[model samples]
Target: MKDSENAVDIKLIFQFFMCCLVAIVFLSSTYLEFSDYAQFQHKLKNKNWVQKTMEITPQMEIEIFHYRNHQSKIIFKENQQEIFSKSCNGQLELICKYIENHEIQIISLNFYTFLDKNTNNYNEFLLNTIAFKDKQGQLQTFPYMTDAPNSPQYIAEIKTEFRSFFIFAFLKHLIFAIMFLGFNLSFNVFKKSTIKLINNLIITTFSLSFISFVIRYFLL
Candidate 1:
């Protein structure tokens, strides 16, 4: 009876350990995806504000560069020397300003793609509307989009751009964690097995973990 109880305890302990391992692995990966998605959303929300600020600035030229990884660099040039550069999803906030006739011309601007971590996809930076505040502190917006903002084409484009990110971030992780826990518990059950049961559990756990990781990598 004592031996049987000890065996059961060992099995439960091992199961708990494997469960913890899976949680840690998935948690870390999910965190990265969450971080990227958050930054992506933040940039999108601020896109309009940035464009307006840029439009309000005086005597400035802007150039955008796209990278293979789907990131973009926006450079602001004044006199071709006081160059201000910022990247999409970067830690630094977009702050554009210039002193003209002793008045601070605080402005913002830029367009850039956002990468979706799960699907390895991204959105194209489209030139939308430009906005700026007038001398009376009233905001004015000008059309800059190729298509009308209310047009079906423009609405469709925005909708499809970030469709997969939220689903993958919330749904996929939950499914994977549930599946991992189920498999880990099943693999740890060793009723009537020989002394090699522990070794079998170890090998099976490691193999499953590795396979899961590979699948996730390819999915990304």
Candidate 2:
């Protein structure tokens, strides 16, 4: 009877470990998804704000480059540059002054064709918007478009665009620890007759954990 009891306890402990592993994977993957979604929303918000600031025309392409220190550059299409170059600078100055006054950090900006205003091919153009975050966690935006003379292309680096989710990282470990303890306590209630069921559960949990880890770290 003593030996049998010891064996049962050992099996229960192992099963608890398996459950803990599954919970860790589930929580970690959830945190990663949340983090990515937060960043995606942040950028989307900035993009929308920039769209509202400009008069878009179909025949023009625009690009705006900005940095954290309130410095910015605008590239316009050749023909449009002659018309809008001075105004673009003045616009940039106002944007920079506002950012500097409010203590905001300009992370990065993306340029793309927002609207093709002109039905005819001649008036079709691309609109550019700049996105930045202020000290109060508010997004600020501005708009510009490209013309003939200034056809400079600004490629924002993908790696630098995302903000780190340090808080999520820390919470991941804390949740894992709590799950480990919870699983251990829950497994203590199982009977020896349910060992087969527990074993199957362990296998399923492990498989799920492995799949989650692969999807989060490799596939994503």
Give the TM-score (vs. native) of candidate 2. Answer: 0.28
* Stretches of candidate 2 exceeding 4 Å from the true structure: 1-53, 56-156, 159-174, 186-188, 191-220
In order of appearance, the predictions have TM-scores of: 0.31, 0.28
lDDT by residue for model 1 (1-220), tens? 9798788778777876876787677667865764574454445454332221234356776555567997666576886754455553432213122122222223444443445557766444544533445556665553445654334575555546545654555454555555554554554344535325554665565456445644553343
Query: Among these predicted structures, which one has the highest TM-score?
Result: 1
Clashes of each: 4, 20
lDDT of 2 by residue, 1-220 (tens): 9799889888778876786677667666866665675454434334322222333345554555565775575444535563232232554666555544656555444444223234522221224656767678887765544421122222122222322433454455455555554554455566755755655565565456445544543222
Candidates' RMSD to native: 13.6, 14.4
Residue pairs with backbone atoms closer than 3 Å in model 1 (clashes):
50-108, 50-109, 53-108, 54-108
lDDT score, candidate 2, position 117: 38
